[model samples]
Target: MSDRAPQPVERRLPTEESRQLVALVRDIVSKEIAPRAAEEEEAGRFPREVFTLLSESGLLGLPYGSDHGGGDQPYEVYLQVLEELAAARLTVGLGVSVHSLACHALAGYGTDEQRAAHLTEMLSGGLLGAYCLSEPASGSDAASLRTKAVRDGDDWVITGTKAWITHGGIADFCTVLARTGVEGPRGITAFLVPGDAEGLNAALPEKKMGMKGSPTAQLHFDGVRVGDDRRIGEEGQGFAIALSALDSGRLGIAACAIGVAQAALDEAVAYATDRRQFGRPIADFQGLRFMLADMATQIEAGRALYLEAARLRDAGEPFSRQAAMAKLFCTDAAMRVTTDAVQVLGGYGYTQDFPVERLMREAKVLQIVEGTNQIQRMVIARHLAGPETR
Candidate 1:
């Protein structure tokens, strides 16, 4: 609602490098990404160059080991960068998060030779990645996935379709989970599959309600062949690797949610201050003022929740339950904040001329991505009351 740019959020950082990193990210967002976000998104154009820019800036490898070419920043720092990007443009923020998710399996579980050979390229050599886990029939019921990978000689043949992949068609590589043995979770195995490998095909991107700048598609791995050397961790360990990655990925989603919510609040406040009704500024009214107050409070709370979880992760402590709570609260908060932002703008917010409408649409996906808020609550419940028996 103010003509001035939203001030940078106050963040407590552990090091000078992180402080500088956040400043650099804000500069890039204001100059390069934010300007084109509305136009590119309306055209459904993906910002491939932005990813290149992020890669070159060393942002793509932030939470990884320096030995493997990462920036070696803590998860707290990495997620704040993601939040800054998401506020400017959610497509870039979410894309970066998904790329990090895609890299998690190999970075954490692959052999030394695998790390030396592929991790450098994935982390620092300007390549993009995707994570494959959900399937046509297994969205929340991931352990029941039907994708099969049969062993043959030193290579494995993979055949299955992965649904709702963020960078499905365009990723340079994919960290895939496929069934290699028994029927449940233990049957699964993780692999690093090249995007152009034989029999790997991505379907047309799905038409979405918002965040059109980012493509979502289904990938078909039809007997795709990958060498055994690409296998990550041991047989029957894929599900664990996938879940571990998700704990971190959920944090990413939470940060992005806060960013979107922040953006919406900014827009609402700016509009309210400038727009006048009945001979006075709408922001002068207590009703709108209270709404804005609530929105800002929720955003701050969500940010604190996610950052707390991230710190737990950086400490190498158990944080799955906290991660789930952050994901649940942040995303739901985004949804609520964005919806209220639209109401704050009244008729103007409902129209495409305002970014609030788009922000509202984009916020919906945050609730669904990584894991749905409903699923997040389920995970939290599991942690609190133990697992549910069928």
Candidate 2:
């Protein structure tokens, strides 16, 4: 064998098709999403109509295969679209992310029969989805989840509570991870549970600090019966499937973080340029100018990281580390940028008059959800130094 080491393959830059997709998304964001965001935010109303509009535009299935009615767009393109949506409304962005996470089990590991029955509606309709993995006890440590799924002849009986479910009360379907074997990660299995299934209930939505339009509630499966056909992949593979989906889901969060930061920057730029102080626009002040520059820089950097991760995913490379890094860096950037954006608006930023306050609140949840920044740090640390360092 030759002694020369293998060279790393560089990812291709965004192609013409990708650029077109981005432009189309920008148009949709500007024309359809941007105008209604403020009204929806004020009313604390979830954007079912907007989602329906997106579905009609084929955005809901942006990254899936065309054979199943998906748009078959690249992850990079899909994430950019998500960034645009998030810039308009965090709830809508989150709805799309949760929907993608929900699609993972069915797309990656579902049997043909299961996909035939559900994937079509999931890809082509206004219906949304929720991923049910975290329990009251298991958030980052999902392998320790307590939900149970017992085989009952022709059906599987699922019983447990899933906590912090996005779209919990409003989703059309949920992909739930439940334990089938003895206690441990290996014991877990995934099941596709319909939202309207008997014995399944969602608690009243939780009061949250941000992303108010997005509902978060506890999903209770009390002896919920599902057909054996609804089980995704092999038994005892739920943990692996969940982790796989999370690896992908982290990119969505990273993109949303970028969007939040970008929105903050946009608001700050608009405000600073307009709001006068000391006989000049606040933006004319060097101090405010530097803050805006910093916010812009951070958003650009975060966007770069998430796009790199998405590129690695599209290239079929090992991307877990990249995804974790993107999630960590981008979310931290979002927190910082949004905080600075608030400072830019001064007192107005502190109040609900502008969107900065909401942006800040939305930025916070990006750090917590789709694996907390703490968990992200752990993941990145492990990747850098190896598990033996623990």
Candidate 3:
């Protein structure tokens, strides 16, 4: 690999403050995140302190409201910050995205009292969070989830397990969805459950192909109980809230995907230009040059797609179809671009000595998470052709 640092991506910011925010994020990534990413990921160590620093710096709350300690920045600006972070280290970027997703319920749907009580602390008080909607048996078909939350006087007792939860074991709070009335989407309700609540336990983290630094695990809510005040929105409204959150969350995933692809492209270009074959840099080869061109183009397209979706969201317009399209195209493009990047480096890319191999593995998961690419296609198709029926 070349010793040169990757050039920073050029961004169009709405204001000077947003420009400075991205600059600060780049500085943090260079000094704090990128330097330790390889070693920590190889060691499977979670960087909890890094998250604390992010919270303290106010980077954690950029897309939420300022009234409750958030930065109240536009989604377009916030997604750019996420892209910069993911380029350095995906664990941190995706962790931040999942944290924002976890906070969505209360910030958007919670009563004034609930927001006053918890939103400030969650957004800026160094607290981490998790979102619990997917279960072991329910991944894409989320409305089929089996977690039960029964009303018990003033409290709701929850029982069942949540699977594939980001920050599962260490989050300070969780936005959970559970069945409260019947057996479908309308029967579910959302709750802001404290992570340390009695009977809320996380199983051992799963070993993964990449991003070992971020823990993904199953959370067992063994009759976990919380006051009715913790409930978000009206009763039997959890699925709608979860779906709304996901529309935004998919954009986050898209941004992260583009970041990873950009990182891979940078590494490939560095290696191709520096490594000599037959007394000439491999990058001079027409085939390899075209490959690099394609990679760069794909990354740009993905970034543009996600940013468009984010701008739509910021304008208070419906963006679910665009979000799904962004998520699908960006993740699929990442997988392809990362694979081509590995090909660009030849043997070097296949080794742990380089980052492209890791990028390849990481790209695979982006296609699977935040509603899989297949699910994204279904969502887009629904928007175009209406819902599928038997």
Q: Each model's C-alpha lDDT?
A: 0.94, 0.87, 0.94
Candidate 3: segments with Cα more than 4 A from true spot? none
Candidate 2 per-residue lDDT, tens place, 237-310, comes to 99999999999999999998888888888788888878887998888999889998988888888888899899
TM-score of model 1 (CA atoms):
0.99
Candidate 1 whole-model C-alpha lDDT, 0 to 1: 0.94
Candidate 3 has which clashing residue pairs, if any? Answer: none
Regions of candidate 2 where Cα sits further than 4 Å from its true position: 1-16, 388-390
Q: How far is candidate 1 from the true structure (C-alpha RMSD, Å)?
A: 0.9
Task: Give one digit per residue, the lDDT tens place, for model 3 in 332-361.
Answer: 999999999889888888998888898899
Clashes of 3: 0
User: What would the TM-scores of all predictions be?
Assistant: 0.99, 0.94, 0.99
TM-score of 3: 0.99
Model 1 CA deviation exceeding 4 Å by range: none
**Candidates ranked by lDDT, best first?**
3, 1, 2
